[model samples]
Target: AKYRINAFHELSERASQTYTTKQMTMEGVGEASRLGSKIINCKDVSYFWEGGCLLKEFSYNFQRFDKVEIVGRNGVGKSTFLDLLTGVLQPSSGVIERGESLVIGYYRQEGMDFTGDDTVLDIVGDTRLLGRFLFPHDMLNTRVSRLSGGEKRRLYLLTILMKNPNLLILDEPTNDLDIVTLNILEEYLKEYGGSLIIVSHDRHFLDRVVDHLLVFCGEGIVKDFIGSFSEYRSYMRDYESAKKKDSIASIKPQSSAKPEKKAEDKPRKLSFNQKRELESIESRLPELEEKKAAIEKDMNSGALPYDKLKEAAELFKQVSNEIDELETRWLELQN
Candidate 1:
């Protein structure tokens, strides 16, 4: 009799849980259906600053069905594109057309600021939504000021969803988020019936979230590819490989006499400046890289005091820029 009662109770609990899940699922569907998007249209858009070109003559229609992932190698100004999209920085030329009833929710790399004393419940005013985002009941009464950086980032995401914006812009959204949180966030984004734009280096995240790409192919050119991130990468790789193969196939066998002439034409000594640069570049690059890594480690380690963090960050950026310049010079020297 006792065993039968226990089994019945377990089954009853599961049925109750299932009923609650059904309710939530229904609510989610209803919420998604109510959502919409704004048509943010860009025409002949270009951005240039400090006598350097970033993007030139780019065009796109950002709408509900479009999930655009901005991709570029570092220093190509993906952030500038984001600024253009969000109206933070006006384009150097061209027109940006926004929808009449557009609402934007932008999640930048920086964490959200929460001032004064406030509980988690006070912030969102709903625990079930928080639970959906991996916040448990124990975390409800926690003070806003006491939350960790990741927690704050997660909360900011939840807040964004709760407000139900018609357009969302995320820049490096996965930087500090845990995998579990990222999974849940991706799930939420899947059901989101709104326009979305993201700038991310996370391949997995890009593969899952975005359907189209705005690629910065260097030299102020942006290629709008109608495919996922993986597809674009595959296409580029295949193109490069075929190009290399064609070059190799085009090379005819050089005569022994031609080889001797080529050897004679080769310079016996590099210029004084070139020699000095070649000698020091190999050592200088490693030092700059080491300094960069050490600064990153200290920043991540939380060892630097709050006031010094900004200084460290600036120094790190300077060192990184130096490394990039030096590496480019080194490659030229090698060539």
Candidate 2:
């Protein structure tokens, strides 16, 4: 009788434990369904510009994801879409639904302003939780007025992070960030558990961080693709090729209305200063490439100590900035 009673008690305990686990799982799923689904929902969304349609019947469902990237050419309403989602701008006509527990941290392309008299340290320190990934220093006393544009960008990122948000909406997050900070931010996002939606022109960064892509094309149409930037490009190329072939096959042969226009090619010309700038950029490119190669070598060989690696990484960032600046100047000269 004693043995039978003990067996019965063990079964009862097991049953109770299973019931508790099931209940907890059900509660978690309920919460996720309520809070993580449909982070940004738009149906028949439209926005108009002067005598033109910026967005026409754009619609998509952006749910919680590890990372999402928004891509498009300039003036395609990418920023406007973000603004509409964040309530910065009201849509002309559409319904947008945000989850109840969704808290958003937005980083705009332009700089953000902190309270006057706030020191860099104070601004950064106040956002320690978010800043820790990038700053990792006690900067509470550093005055914002003294901070550089890059520093300000970092601080803004930290401020958004400090809010402990469920969703992160970054607009051109890489615009002014140093390469080191950008890499650090990438690492953090890779490990972050919450949802992320970002707009960036940095192709490499998008390739590394985002698992999904949202493209805003003119005419109020948003395209969704479930892959990285490279994948999206590949898909786009294939689609265009197929479309071209189909069009060619469907066209009926007809006489040309006017003389066939010959494709004209012209020799490119550059001014003296422009040529010099291009030369300067070209000269610097190899040096940066060499430095990058050296860092990779050191990392591969395990010859760099932790401190040395960190220093090298910082130098790499500086070089990258110099390269970008030079390239930008060169492009302007070409234009």
Candidate 3:
């Protein structure tokens, strides 16, 4: 079917798209001696649990204005790393130095400690900020004990942001947040004036906010990658592919008579970036098809005016062309 072909085309095109680097600058306001350049420093930091090493030889001088995300599989000591950074848990071997003026606002995965008959307004005085977190004016008087689990989490997150700490550490921040609230949080963090350190499984949130990644590859290995989560994933894919090819090369029986190498002998391998692009494309193609289908339906309906019908037709054409180009690219990538 024509619709199916267009869908495939769009998928290919979306897969090839790349992300642009996000850069933002804020104007400095007032002379304040309350902040330091070096936020935290750890030298040869290592932690052990149940006679097994969790983190080892981790040394980094965390600076002011650094947006970092800690990424690893569950039970890989990501939260423990955060605990060590915040002084909740001490490293077994190394020293962690905290800044004198450092005021840390930590949002734990276990949620907030606030409990009792206190109203939401009583807990968070800022009604404007509360509304952004989906707490309406009528909801302000709602008691903390009466609020739902999600509501309680949102209120807790708002409380942390309100502290205006110079160093903000969030563990699993996106867990209880709705999509709209998550958007509001992302926007707030984009303009936030502090150094942000987060431990979250939300890939989109990480890619949107953090500038770099601290990837934990089990057994006390941490790779400090200078890019988004998607980029890091792409790099890993490419690295693994190269290793695989090398492995295949090593096991082959050596021929006493070497065959002549042809120009097209080696098969081209997809780079991690390309693989990521294809993944993104596959994710977006369905959405694009939906848009196209909507446009077609609009055009087919007799209720549209001449101008409106023309507009819908034009849009449909544009989408079709895009799908076609993307499909071509996709095929090329496959080959």
Candidate 4:
């Protein structure tokens, strides 16, 4: 516990330094005199991988200055769809058209590789830009291998911005970034003139930056919603709750209509242990949901310590997974 406290203090100090450091800016340069209103068009696009459909007949027009986020569970083809849009992968069917003047910049989750011996100056030739990124002249000789995770991510982000792309695609860009850097990025994006598409699990980041969302529901389905991430989440909660109530109401009516089946014809009932487990799950579900809500509130509050924020993010994932599992089992038992 003492070591943890010390580590937190060190992280806090680093964050303070990062905050006082000079800020970074991004600008997009297009080849044409002016960019088209529709920067990209996805015409009935479908992508299949490993014998399974990732996206099916997806059609959307991406316009200049459009800030869109793609969100879904893990392994739900969010990244794959981005790849299709960026031309890294061909669509299984249909087409993706890009504007002639569009210059796209992509930031992948697996960041650009750096040789251990490469110095910060070697990666970024401009000392002024290095200073803007918190790498002063004294630290120019610092090797990439020795830089902290946050530092390396900052460097990689600088590289992406240097390209001056009209369309920016970022995949999980918030991971391993310091809060100060994240703030700067959010501020820059708020003023950024380009078309932005982001794939990130950072709910707070999504709520702050994007105007609309392309929700990747499972099974090759995506829903477009014109609202912030928090609003979408709240809407889904209400929708699911209403649907569950309807299901329960319908089930009760069915039970009243159905005659009692013969002993041999009735389906086997849940064992005693299963029934107890189901009851236990039902009792715990509300408590878990409340805990999850609290965690989410803290995440969006922007007041949590940097170290605690990382812990909360991980815990949030675990709690969400547990809830999903329990809900699935509860539905099975009800059936």
Q: Is candidate 1 or candidate 2 better by lDDT?
A: 1
- What would the TM-score be for candidate 2 when compared with the true structure? 0.64
lDDT of 3 by residue, 1-335 (tens): 01122211221232223212333243142111256766787777889999888888877777656788886766778899999999899899988999988988899978587767899999999888888778999988888998877788999998887776888899988775654577678888887766789987555567788977776766776656667766665565465566557546644475553344422344456889887777676566557767876876676577889898867766765775565455334433432
> Which clashing pairs does model 3 show?
9-327, 13-326, 14-281, 15-277, 15-281
For model 2, state the Cα shift of residue 53 in Å: 1.6
lDDT of each: 0.68, 0.63, 0.70, 0.71
Tens-digit lDDT track for model 4 on 187-251?
77776667789987665667788866787766676766666766665564454456546444444
Q: TM-score winner among the candidates? A: 3
**Alpha carbon deviation, residue 197, candidate 2 (Å):** 1.3
CA error at residue 220 for candidate 4, angstroms? 1.3
lDDT of 2 by residue, 2-116 (tens): 1122211222123112111112232222112224554666667777777677777666655554477876666668888888889888878877778777788788876487775
Please write out the lDDT profile of model 1 over residues 1-335, one tens digit for every residue. 01122211221133112111112243333123233343677777888989988978776656554577887777788888888888999999988888877777888876476764988888887678899988899989899899888898888777777777667788888766755577688887777766678887555556787777776766677755556765764564454455546545545586654766555544344588997886697667668767766876777686779788878867765775676566445434432
Question: What is the lDDT, from 0 to 100, of the residue 269 in candidate 3?
Answer: 63
Q: What local lDDT score does residue 78 receive in model 3, on the 0 to 100 scale?
A: 87
- In terms of lDDT, the poorest run of 10 residues in model 4 is 15-24
Q: 1 or 4: which has the higher lDDT?
A: 4
- Top candidate, metric lDDT: 4
